[model samples]
Target: MTAEVQSVDIASPIDVISEPVILTYFETLNAGDFQATADLFAESGVLRPPFDEELVGREAIAQYLAAEAKGMKFQPLMATYGVLETGDTEFTITGKVQTALFGVNVAWNFVLNPDSQILSVQIKLLAGLEELLNLKPGQDKKKE
Candidate 1:
């Protein structure tokens, strides 16, 4: 009789991610502390959007925030809805944002460094973003 070894898969996706840092992100964003939110990322961090060009560096991120704040008349009342672990160092954060216009669900894909600093964040929409923002596909609110 011969003994055989079996391999098991460990790359399973987790349903909920309890990261305090992620919670802080929403808190800072809701507080209108754009600079503090940018500081949560690493020095060379990048913010990628679904339709717009990628923004890199703290300064660029700050400029983007400033432009958006000026253009948009409302801010969302956001709360973390759930999280999904996608990879060893990556996860997707899902949230519900309630605005005056409408309520929308959004997803944020985050890649973190060893030090817990965010390396990149890709923003995605699950529902109601377009109609609520009153924009078309590929249209930028920053231009308003």
Candidate 2:
């Protein structure tokens, strides 16, 4: 059997997103624990997912995450994605994503600052998602 689908808060993956972190934020988003994700963000950090406005700061991130939690369910898939240490204070990560809320598959290349805390998050959804996914601009299916 596949991993049982469950309702997970998108922010729930924060704790597990360690250095060279591999996370499934979108996949884990449920009804609770979003604040946990926001907390992992640097104070002036931002999360940009294509079309939507950039969500900056812990407060704004919390609001965005909370809204996501209320609107959809998550099932962040586990894959052996890798990370690139592009800079002394930066890391780039790539991985798969799926959520009942999104109805599609996605990926993200998160750029974390040297502090090992999230600074900016960029998102992408694989091509097949255009038919069903409702993510932001760059992450939209047609582009991916």
Candidate 3:
């Protein structure tokens, strides 16, 4: 499924996001460990995508992720651009994402329960690719 288009302030300064849970989320996804990824969430956790239907509960979330992993081919190059501490247990992470098809900016808003389990996650699309997917903004042009 295609993600909804989003608008982001690209000029905002990007800060390094070094959250362990965030890192594990990406790592598990990239590794194609759908169950492991779902295990990171709380039993009744929710996964909200930019375009697709929301998946709630561990079983539903795992099933969705498993299906996506089976269907999609590309792995994204994701870089954390910023993060906001929305509350004591809630945070939002903004990042630049690139894959074989296109590049996009995205945000992952997460809520964690007392046990550090992810209680909910909302994935938002921020923007589409403006430059070539393989060439990051400041990179030099390839020699002819």
Best by lDDT: 3
Tell me the TM-score of each prediction against the true structure: 0.62, 0.57, 0.63
lDDT of 1 at 69: 38
Q: Cα RMSD (Å) per model?
A: 10.7, 10.3, 8.7
Q: Count the backbone clashes (under 3 Å) in each candidate.
A: 0, 11, 1
The residue pairs found clashing in candidate 1 are none
Candidate 3 Cα lDDT to native:
0.63
Best by TM-score: 3
lDDT of 3 by residue, 1-144 (tens): 112322333343222334566567767776778898899998889999877999999899989889765433222233332222433266566665544444456677777765678888888777544544455543443456
Winner of 2 and 3 under TM-score: 3
Candidate 1 regions with alpha-carbon error over 4 angstroms? 1-17, 69-88, 128-144
Name the regions of candidate 2 deviating beyond 4 angstroms: 1-31, 71-102, 128-130, 133-144
Question: Residue-wise lDDT of candidate 2 within 34-137, one digit each (tens)?
Answer: 77677677899888875589999989988887775465544443322233445423333333444443354455555565566777776665555456444653
What is the full ranking by lDDT, best candidate first?
Answer: 3, 1, 2
